[model samples]
Target: MNRRESLKDPDDLEFFDRIQKLHLSLDQEFLNQFQRSLPLNEVLIDRWERASRLGFGDQTSIYDSSLVLGNVQVGKSCWIGPFTVLDGSGGLSIGDHCTISAGVHIYSHDNVIQTLSSGRFPIDRNPTTIGRNVYIAPNVVIAKGVNIGDCCVVGVGSFVNKSFDSNKILVGQPAKCIGEVIVTDSSIDFKYF
Candidate 1:
């Protein structure tokens, strides 16, 4: 169904249009206080990243609209892109200088089987860890308990379900080491074969 047609109030539609034109942004302070007030359906374009108060480290940035849950610990100089889900409900820790691209979803719990079983099966919960200088590309889905080492690049649209060593490029579903990453003093390169 079309969103415009679904709205019952004319004023609501007007407000939505006005916000679209104005391109307003919500800062970290506002988000923390009124997180529950934000609508889930609206397309959010938030650019607000603060200090460790919001579960981030020094020089780390996370969109105000992003959904971050649980004991998430992020180190310095990390860039968590917009519309990402950093679900640390179990536990999550990320080291310095990591880049989590837009539309990425990192979770510490899985309820796929348990949801279908109606409490017959228990939900799996685990801790997730990301090492220093890791790069997670757009639209990647990281499952529970996955540990990503330093200088690793997770390619776009990959579904990572397992742990990997450092300096490798992970790609494809259930992600594989399709390449390697080399970092120098001035440049970071990916070698694919």
Candidate 2:
């Protein structure tokens, strides 16, 4: 028998079988609705359970493939998607109702100077904060010391290196304000520049 087969106890075998069944069901459902399959870990662990384990606020869900480092504080009703990195070695705070999309990386520290200086220079550390109701798109990177204000939408694949005010639509390499978000009771709109 194979090494894997020999190592499996009865309980382990049963658990693996259940996991396989769950994956199939979930994959079918996801394909029907979104034309995609659920990530393996997402099929195994409930998102809310993972969030609760990390002390995130109520109703926040962080994917199993996301990596969250030191001193990160996330508020309620936020969605942290798969393959993202939240580097909080210098402290990071994300406010309520935010969507940190897939492949996003937010850093609160960097070792560029240290590495270039052959360990003579110390790593840079700074706080990175994301305000309430922000939407950071897929593959975006937010650097250390950047504070994004409330209701901002960061476009996909953008690289944000500076702070931005509330209600801005930001995009591009060193993301620039390209539009504004207008919000009123029962209505919301985006006005592009």
The global C-alpha lDDT for each of the candidates, from Candidate 1 onward, is 0.83, 0.94
Please report the TM-score between candidate 2 and the true structure.
Answer: 0.86
Error of 1 at 129 (Å): 0.8
TM-score of 1: 0.74
lDDT of 1 at 120: 95
Model 2: lDDT to the true structure: 0.94
* CA deviation > 4 Å runs, candidate 1: 1-51
State the lDDT of candidate 1 residue by residue for 15-106, as single tens digits: 87776554434333346666633443232534333435675777887776578888889898988877899999879898999999989999
Candidate 1, overall lDDT?
0.83
1-193: candidate 2 lDDT, tens digit per residue: 8634865598888887787788899878878976878877676678889998999999999989999999999999999999999999999999999999999999999999999999999999999999999999999999999999999999999999999999999999999999999999999999999
Candidate 2: segments with Cα more than 4 A from true spot: 1-19, 25-36
